[model samples]
Target: MRPETEADLADMIASASGPICVRGGGTRGVHLDGAVLETGGLSGITLYEPGSLTLVARAGTPLAEIEAALDAEGQRLAFEPMDHRGLLGTSGAPTIGGVVSANVSGPRRVSVGACRDFMLGVRYVDGTGTLVKNGGRVMKNVTGYDLVKLMSGSWGTLGVLTEVSLKVLPKPETAAGVLIDGLSDVDAVQAMAKALGSPFEVSGAAHIPRGLNGQPVTMLRIEGFAGSVAYRADQIASLFGGMSVRVERDPETVAKGWAWVRDVDTFQGTEGDVWRVSCTPSDAAGLGAKMKLAALLYDWGGGLIWARVPEGTDLRTRLGAFDGHATLVRGAGQAKFQPEPAPVAALSRGLRARFDPKGILNTGLMG
Candidate 1:
């Protein structure tokens, strides 16, 4: 069921008997066996306000197109949403609706926020064939239930998003990186935490494991006007005095390095099951030490850990002791997401029932 308009989609859902799998470019790679509803036909940007740093676009609008439009205005989606095509091994086009539905964000998420933070508004069709609208085109348009936040990460189970409004930010004038060499995993995590606590406003931080590439490297990023960026870079380098410190001032080099960490570029080619684990930064050092048996990297100042474990490894059982959740981003594993607690699971089921009375939307995708 390909919908060219929201009305068309609502009518189709009104008549659907069996389950329906909603797709935005279909790059999510979650194999849902049911009638597929493609959203590519409902494309195009509806509005762009550079002065206000706001953007409204159809849900099916290509993410790349929105980025290009933002780039032209020296602005961007501050959350820095990631592109998962490489990791998922799928060639389907990525759409803005998909990014919002999945709540995808990149390295800078450590500083700014996730996709939900930037989502100001959304228009979707609930499972019972009801056209629902929540939020508005501006951040101050707060009037009712914050369903926009709820829909951001619902993965199209509660509703089918037809449009979205996001809060964008001006691009940084310049950027630089302070790279510390030869730090052990534990030491690297501490160093990143220190940098994040400083007044320089570190925008990105990650550690490349020594086991993976011979020498461990800790990277800290600062972005702003040229003078401020240079001053902060030097200040951060001075903070790491006596260590093997290198400042990357070249814009291209800085971008390339961060992009590598943001997209998990190195692991894209590795043949193994990849897991995205989120935990408190204080717990990251311990978790990394325990997971030393596998290939790993730390992002979000050690809060987000991306690990590549051997195939058929039961991650939930292996990581049951940890407080955070582990998501299987790749491989045909037993589960792709962490199981919710009993109470939370009950609430989720109840909410699904209210939004989708017939249970006709992406059944079992969350479990």
Candidate 2:
């Protein structure tokens, strides 16, 4: 648990051996074992360029704390990664930098894009112990290579982020959700796709398995002013037709409900192995058809599916067969967050050459 000040970071980068997991309270400790870089020492907001709709903060700032500040100004870091401290059945603080580095996206990703979209700039200690920066506080800069987006999802293999600047948006004044209860996996995917194709401007849509479904819900959430959300939700309901619907006007209920779509908070106690697979929405059902798993949960409409497998069930070849990637999201790891190293994974090995040439930052993570 070595916490480094800015100067200390400069010194360590020059001499450190072994991969350093830049940890923020170990929110993701289960994912890997490497030398830890205790990023909390670097925590603090450096700048809030509200005029440009951007804010810069140290890497280890608590995401909850950042959101509270953003809320006060009616602004938010829009990608909205799921708070896994509670949902993953774990306990600890998660950092916003960690979220972006992980490239996590929640329900709003359907509308706003992932954390990669909002990230604008970064300062980090790279493999060579040199301080490197890319992008700027504003969105339009292209002074050099677009390293900001590259760093966003690099999983700290390239560098240990010291600071990050990102775009922010005004929080919507009101939001409403409508549930279309009792739809099968294929049907639920259809409804979500249909809703997005329409002009109702729906912000969130998801379907949970009926067995896993607490309330048998197929939910659609719309955000804006009271009048706008109310109007859009009504039109969406009309578009979907009467399927035993119930309106959720309660804001707190709406927030809590959408969270399930983010990270399967409701399915926490289910033990075994959980995985997050990225594929086309249509491939979601194929995942069920393919993998023999303990349980499965779908999020991101269907683009992201979470499956709980009996311990030691290999999802690699099965998931890779569907032409997508499966990451070990939780539970014990053969090697956490990593699937059994793929044959063509030398591509990742090659990437390490250009970024962390010395493999001094986070070696095995993306290697």
Top model number, lDDT? 1
Name the runs in model 1 displaced over 4 angstroms: 211-213
> What are the lDDT figures for the candidates, one per model?
0.90, 0.76
Error of 1 at 231 (Å): 0.2
**Candidate 1 — what's its lDDT?**
0.90
Q: Give one digit per residue, the lDDT tens place, for model 2 in 1-367.
A: 5555667886777777766666665666544566667787888887886667888899888888888888889998777788776546667788877887888778898888999888888988787778888988777887888888888888888777888888999998888898888877777888888887788777887776653435456778888898888888888888767577778888778888887667677657766777778888877877765775446666666777778788777787666556567787776645555443466577766666766787766656654
Tens-place lDDT digits, model 1, residues 1-367: 7889989999999899999999998776877878998889889999998998899999999999999999999998888888888877788788999999999999999999899999899999999899999999888888999999999999999999999999999999999999999998888999999999999999999998853467889999999999999999999999988899999999789998988888788788779899999999889888877765778889999999998889878877877667789888988847888999999999999999999998988889997
The prediction achieving the highest TM-score against the true structure is 1
Clashing pairs in 2: none
